[model samples]
Each structure stands twice: as C-alpha cells, then as structure tokens.
Target chain A: MDNQTKIHIKNLNLHIGKQQILKDINVQIPKNKITVILGPSGCGKTTLLKSLNRLTDIYPDIKVEGSIEIDGQDILKVKKRDVTDIRKKMGLLSQRPYPLPMSIYKNITYGLKISGRRRKRFLNKRVEHYLKQASLWDEVKDRLKDPASALSIGQQQRLCLARGLAVDPEIILADEPTSALDPVSSQAIEEKFVELKERYTIVMVTHVLRQARRIADHVVFMYLGEVVEQGSAEEVFGNPKEERTKAYLRGAFN
Target chain B: MKRFFKINRKIRNTFHKRWMLLSLIVVIAMPIVLGVGLYLKSAMLLEQTSLIKLLFSKEWKPMQGLFGLWPFIVSSLWVTILALLIAGPICLLAAIYMTQYTKKYFLRMMHPVIDILAGIPSVVYGVWGVIFVVPLVSNHLAPFFNTQSSGYSILTGAIVLAVMIIPFILNILIEVFRNIPDQLTEASLSLGATHWETVKHVLVRKAFPGIVSAFGLGISRAFGETIAVLMVVGNVTQIPKGIFQPGYPLPALIANNYGEMLSIPLYDSALMLSALVLFVVVLLFNFASRMAIIKLERHT
Candidate 1:
C-alpha cells in the first residue's frame, strides 16, 4: 500500500442477484485528492463508491469478493459495532439531496447530536463552520431555524454537503452530486468540491465527463463494471488511452 | 376571424387548467355535504336533551324508559383505546420489521396474510374470538386475577377487536412506511446510526402523520365495528370497572336492538339517535385528526 493511499480495492467483484456487476476492480484512492469515477449510468460507479464505506452491505443476497481497505484496515472485516465508526470517518452525498426533514441548522448538526455532543455552543459553531464551508451559510444564515426543505434545490444540495462536512470526516464520497442540478447549481457545487479537496479526500462518481474535467485531480473511467482507464485528470482527458475510453469521451453512446 | 377561434382556444385551455382545481374542491366538500345533510335529518328526528344529559346519559334501555347512553359511550371509547393499546405496538413493530428488517419474499408472504385477515368478515372474527380467544384468556389469563371466569368479558372484546384491527393498522402503516423514499432510510443509516435508531429517529418521525392517520383510521374502524363486539363483549351495558369486567359498546347495543323496534317513535328515534351518535363520533374523530395533521404540518 502506498503511504498516500487511503482506500484500496483489490480484486473486488460484486454480483446483484444473478448479474455480475463489479468485476475484478482494483484501485487505490489517494489521500487529500479529488478522485472522480466517471462512467455511464448503471456501470457500477456508485456501487464501487458505496463499497468503500460498506454501505452496499445493507442489501442482502449481494455477493462481494476480494477486499476493500481504508487506511489498510480491511473495511469488510470490520464488525457491525464498528460500522458506524468506519462510516463516521467517511461521508456520502447521494445523487439527490435529502437534507433531513429538519431545520437547516439542525440538518448540519445532525451527525454531532447523535454522536453525543450535547453542548450548545460547540454544536452551534460546528454547524456554522460546515455551512460556511459548503457556501450556503450566507444565503441561509438568517433562516437557520427554517426547515432545510424550504430552500431551493441548489440550496438543499449545498445544505446536504454542509451536513456531510459536519461529521468532520476524512473522506467524502459524492455519487453524482451535481447531476441533478442545473448548470449554475452544478458549477456552485463543483467549485465547493474543488475547494474542499485541500482538507478532505473526495471520491466522486459522475456520468458527465465535463464535470470530471472541471473538478477532478484524478479520474477513473469505468465501463461494464471494469476500469477502462484511470490517471491524473489532465493525462486521462488530454492523452490517448484505451479505445473504449476514447469512444466514450467522443460521446459515442451518451 | 382567426382571432375569434383563438379566443375559444384560450377559453378551452383555461378550463383545462382549472379542471383539477374544480375536482379537488368537489372531492373535499362531498363528505362535509353528506355529513351536514345527515345531521340535519337526525336533528329533526332527535329531541334535544340538555347538553349535560345528552353527554352524561346512563342506562340506555329505551324499552324500559331508561334512555341514557353514557355507559355505552364510555364503553366504546374504552374499547377503541384498548384495541389501540394492544394492536398499536404489535402492528407498528411488525410493520417496521416488514418494511425495514426483512426481505421482499418475507414481506410478500406476510402481506397477503394481513390482507386476508383484513378481508375476513367481522362475523368470522367474532366466531373465532368466541371459540378460541375467549377460552385462551379465561384459561390462561383469568387465573392470574383469581377470577372464576371472564367469559365474554371486556378483555375478551378488546382482544377480539385488537385482532380484528391488527391488519388495519399493519396495512396502513405498511403503506405509510412504504411511502417514504428509500433514500430517507439510507441517508439516516449511512450517517452511522443503527437500524433501530434510524427507524426511531428518521423513518418513524418522518412517517408520524401517516402513522397517526392510520391510528385514527384504526380507532374509527374499531369504534364503529358492531358484530364482533356484540358477540364477544358479554352484552353487559355498563362502564367496565377494569379489563376483566363485562361491558357493552354503543354499536353492539344498537345492533342487538335494531331488529326489535316495532312502533314507538322514541325507540326508533333512540336507535337513530345512537346511529347519529356513532356518526357524530366518527365525523368528529376524522375532522379533529385532519385539523391536528394540518397544525402539525404547518410546524413541519
């Protein structure tokens, strides 16, 4: 394992029901870098992202083979008691924003309260910190008491990001975080993703190639449950690579 | 002129936009219209007792000139509360298990069983309660209280009603739990909360309105259920001292006497009055629940 490697997938395979979904996947997600997984929909980008934190284990009858490790601690071997601990170290933003049917302030501090921080001032500061980090603090600072759902779609997504950041996780897994947003909203989220990469390691799954170009430091291109190409974003996007990757970049299948 | 037909087009398009609004207004107002109409007709038939007597009437034996209904009214409330007490936890937990913990096959298996139970006639539930439940409680539960027998007791009716309404609670809760987006549950669980904690804090909280409505629906169904209560309730029309005591509900009392009303307007009026009482209770329950939901909805 490289010293900079935070998550390593070795010979990983997954099957949902009778269909083999992820096949022989091997990747090492680097620390403090924006690594974007780009692929067509249903090509297992989200599944691979979920496998890092063992979120996919919530489903029954899915067969997973090989090993996934975070900080060289094999996540699959982690017991049920430690799942939360492992999950706490990583935060996931779904494709759609679900900002908890709670007040915006409460939404940001949700992860803290259940972790047993009952102090008033500390929780308040943490809420303000993350909300600002996601760039939604200014827009929503006055309406902190209002329901998070009252915000516009873009604001809701940012609030979800703020909520994710509240836990102080080392890695943030974003599954198509901006796919559901308009271009302006998408750009807003993209800039935040770039800004946060200095402090937090981000593994993002996106269907849009342009999104990968705009934000990713490194890119992992997947097709049919296999990694076709992966490199620094500049190299992967600029230089020649696998035929399938080139075809995909050309908008051959959309 | 071309402009003339375009004005007709504009009118037609405007009507299309308003159609759903019109439909919503009509659907929402239909029940109020029906209820108000029934109330007016019943008001014409029922002689107004003073407010106190109307509410506190005891010993509702119209045949013998005792036309107070406080006993049956209290009995109905008690039985509905009891059914909720017994069925609420079981149905909700079972619904939780079905919705969250278990797989599709298990849910597929359990759902139809609940549907079949829900579909079973009230009479069948009564027969089953009398044959099996009454015996089980008398043999297993009564001895704990040092009672000789609680045959056809309040406990028996409550148990029967609970069983009858189990599917109702479970079915509606199943729908409510299912109505929540899967992402909601996943979001909570991925936050590192345990499955139980997610259910308590997220799933149940989000579905509170739906669950409460389901409960209100259950209470209304149990309150209005007659044949099942009549068969197993010991047919004693008085306020039950406790779970082990015998009791009768208003619906059961009405069902028992509905066939025997011959000529007297008071007898027919009393039955109509009781039916009107049942209608009023149901209407108030629904309206109050709707108001409560709206108030809570405003806060949410």
Candidate 2:
C-alpha cells in the first residue's frame, strides 16, 4: 500500500498443469529504482518477471492465482481486450534479441504505428530520439533503411532495446538481457540501466551475481520458488540476514 | 585374432564407401536420364513442325496431321491457377490459425487427418469429383450465376484440384509457421501489440519465403495432376473462354489419346510432345520458385 511501490504482488502463485512454478509470493517493487531478481537457474526469476506484464498468459495450462497490482490496478484481473494497455505500461527485454523481420527504421516505428501514431514527421523524430536514448544512434543512424537482421548480435540487442523504449513505458522488465551478449555489449546495457533507473522502474532477472552487484538498488534473492530475502543492495549484499543468502553469496551451489 | 578382425573391418569400410558413392551417382543421373528420354521421344514431332507453331497453334486434326497445342496449354494454365487461387488463402489462414491460435493438442490431432487426406489415391479423388463436385458446379453454382453448362467443366476440375492440393500446401505452411522462433512473437507482444498484430507484422513477415515456396510447390503439383482433373475437365480441344466451359489440358491429352496414338502417323509423336511439355513446365516452375526463395532469404 506504500505510495513508492510501483508494483505490489500479494499471495501470487502460478502453476503449469500439476507442477508449481512460483509459490505464494509477496513483494513491493519501488519506483524509479533498479530491482534485480537474483537467483540461480530454474529458480523462477524469469517467470516472476514475465508475470508483471502478463506474458505468461500466452502459455497454455498456466493458472495464475492472486493479484499483481501495477499503479493500484490488478493487472491479473484485466480483461483480454485491455491486456495490451496493461502491457504498454512496461518494456521487456528477453535473453535474445529478436528484431522484427523488417528494416531498422520500421522496427522502431512498429510499436508507434500499432498504437495509431501515423504522422511521419513524428515517427522520424521519435526513432532518432529512442536510438539516442539507447546510445546506439551514431552507429546505426546512416543505415536505418537496412533490414534489422543484418546487424551484429550486439547491435541487434541495442535495436531491440530502442524499439522497446519507443513504446514509452513506465517500467522496464529485462529477463537476463545481457546473457547472450559479449562483455562489452553487456557493460553497455548495464550502464544504460544505471542511467535509465533515474526515470523508470527497472526489474531485471539475472543469475550472474556480478551483474546483480553492479547496478541493483533493490535486490530480491529467490531460491526454490520462494523469496529468501528482499532489501536494499547494502542490506542484502553487505549485511547478510538469511543463511541461504549467505551461502549463495559465498560461491555456493548455483 | 585382432589382426584378422582389423583387416576384415578395413575391407568392409571400403565396400561401404563404394556403395554410397554408387547410390549418389544413380540419384544424380535419374533426372538427367528422364530429361533425355523425353526429348528423344518428342524429337520426331519437333523435327516435322516448328516449335513456335506447335506451341502457339490450336488446330487438332489427327488425319490431316495438324497438332497445335495452344488450347491444351491454356486449359492447363487456367486449371492450375484457379486451383491455387482457391486454395492459397484458405491454406495460409488455416495454417496460421492452427499454429498461432489453437492449442498444441489440437494441432497434434490434425497431423494424421492431413496425412490421410494426402494419402488417398488420386483415382478415389476423381470418383469423388465425378460424384460430388460436378453436380455442385453444374446444378448449383452455375445456375446461381445464371449460366448453363454440363457437370463436367474447368470449374469442376479446379474445385477437385484445389481439394487435392490443400493437404500438401497446408502441411508445408504449418511447418513454416511453427519454425518461426517464439522469441519474435514475444518481442512483438511485449511492445503492446495484440496477438493478431504480432502475427501479421512479425510471424507472417518472417515466414514469407517459406510460404512462397509452399505455394510454388502446390502450383507444380496441381499442374501435373492427371486422374482427378482428367475426369472432371471436359476433354474439348478448343480453348475455354470461361470457368464453366469444357477444355483439354496437356496431361489429359496424353492420357486420353495414347491408346490410339499408334494407329495415326504423327499422333504418337504428338502425345510424347505433350508429356514433354508437362515435364519442362513443372521443371521451370520449380526452378523459378527456388530462385525466389533464395532471393527472399538474402533480403531478410
């Protein structure tokens, strides 16, 4: 119920058929800060991130119980017709970059065009603005008309980030966004996130502890579908309260 | 014992390599052999008449030795194109719905149904056309459009041909839609685009080349279909001016006349030329489609 909480999860549980993926979870994600969900593989980090924007609805046999509130609205209860509006409030970055099968300029304009933005002059300006925001404007400004698939993997990931940002979302959810990139590209994304946290509520999921330590303002450590600890970066990383968290930070089992 | 076994294994390996090499050579030579044989058999007609005249003229008297093939060529083109026009949209939409909208279990259930449809004999399809499609066209569709015609017409042949090729085209399209990675769909959806929008902008765009090749293969299959089409398409030698009119296609011409061709002087040669034409047209179509797919792949 705190005013600073951008997203509040209450008793949320998810099941795929008979297998439970996420246990009853309660957490408060603050506004204008980087909240990193840190966990090892198969620990439901990506699943928790996906549930924020209702991306899990695409999967069959997925039963979600309880509420996921964003801006005081329970997104889980929104009707099918209104889900797109709910999704429009969040930008998501996946593990791999999947550029639209289109030219680079069109990829950025796709989100704008679908939202009924038809003015060519407006679209052209926004494309450049978002590319600049992602720090990729100079590298790709000349070849905007080329197909997006022609770009290298790092450039393509940047293009995807630019495309997501063009939607003008209030929150950014990234699921291991740098796992597929080289170290240089990974650092670029990490730096961009640190800068972007000033304006947007960023929720990132990553198994890389080094990444979690670099930019996370709020850290939520999870294990076996349960949140083991949640607090400020200093409290969770510097002053360990839970034994599991202590063991995990000390180069224990992944 | 170990030395003897090693020597035996070396001999077996050589035999295996030579056997594979011979099989590869035979596979490579099959098409070449077919092309050469068809050319030689059709050489007599080509030597007697100019290629342009034989292809462009429409005369068809056996006693007078006139064998123009323009009408048959036109009929074949009409039937194949009409069949594609009928089946193309239906198959594409069906494939998208099956892969994108339906559940996995539903798609799994449809696999065997499509296979059975494809496996049914062509003669069985011909009989079905004679019984069902012919009446539907002449008694219902033609009358509704204020036209008069016999049950057997090009329209009937196209209807039958479209049904026959549906399973083939649908199978390829299903695979094309399914092969597109889920990541693209997720990216589009995450941008606040609806499911329909994501499918239109991303999935269809990515699958464009595969869809083109699928339809191209369908066109080739419909072009050479003999039994079902031959039964429904009225064997008139004149060019068909409308879908309701009877016409003769190249495959039907060869099938219907090969029995009596030996008695006529140049009839046998003309029939062989008809077969040759079918072979070359299908070959050209397949080659063109492969080129289109490659160009699309490079662009994307």
Among these predicted structures, which one has the highest TM-score? 2
lDDT of 2 by residue, A1-254 (tens): 88899999999899977899899999889999999999989989888998899888877767899899998999999998889998888998999998999999999999999999989999999999999998889999999999999998999989999999999999999999999999999999999999998889999999999999999999999998889999999999999899999999997968
Q: What is the lDDT of every predicted structure here?
A: 0.83, 0.93
A1-254 per-residue lDDT for model 1 (tens digits): 77988888899999988899999999878889999999899899988988888877667757789999889889888887878888888888999998787788888777888898879999889988888888888898899999877898899888888888788789999999887898999899888888888898999999988878888888899999999888888888898379988998899865
Off by over 4 Å in 1: B1-45, B145-149, B261-265
Docking tier of model 2: it is: medium
lDDT of 1 at B67: 68
The ten-residue window of minimal lDDT in model 2 chain B covers B260-269
Residue B290 deviation, candidate 2, in Å?
A: 1.5
Report the Cα lDDT for residue B9, model 2.
100
Top of the candidates by lDDT? 2
lDDT of 2 by residue, B190-257 (tens): 89999999988889999999999999999999999999999999999999999999989999998998
lDDT of 1: 0.83
Off by over 4 Å in 2: B1-4
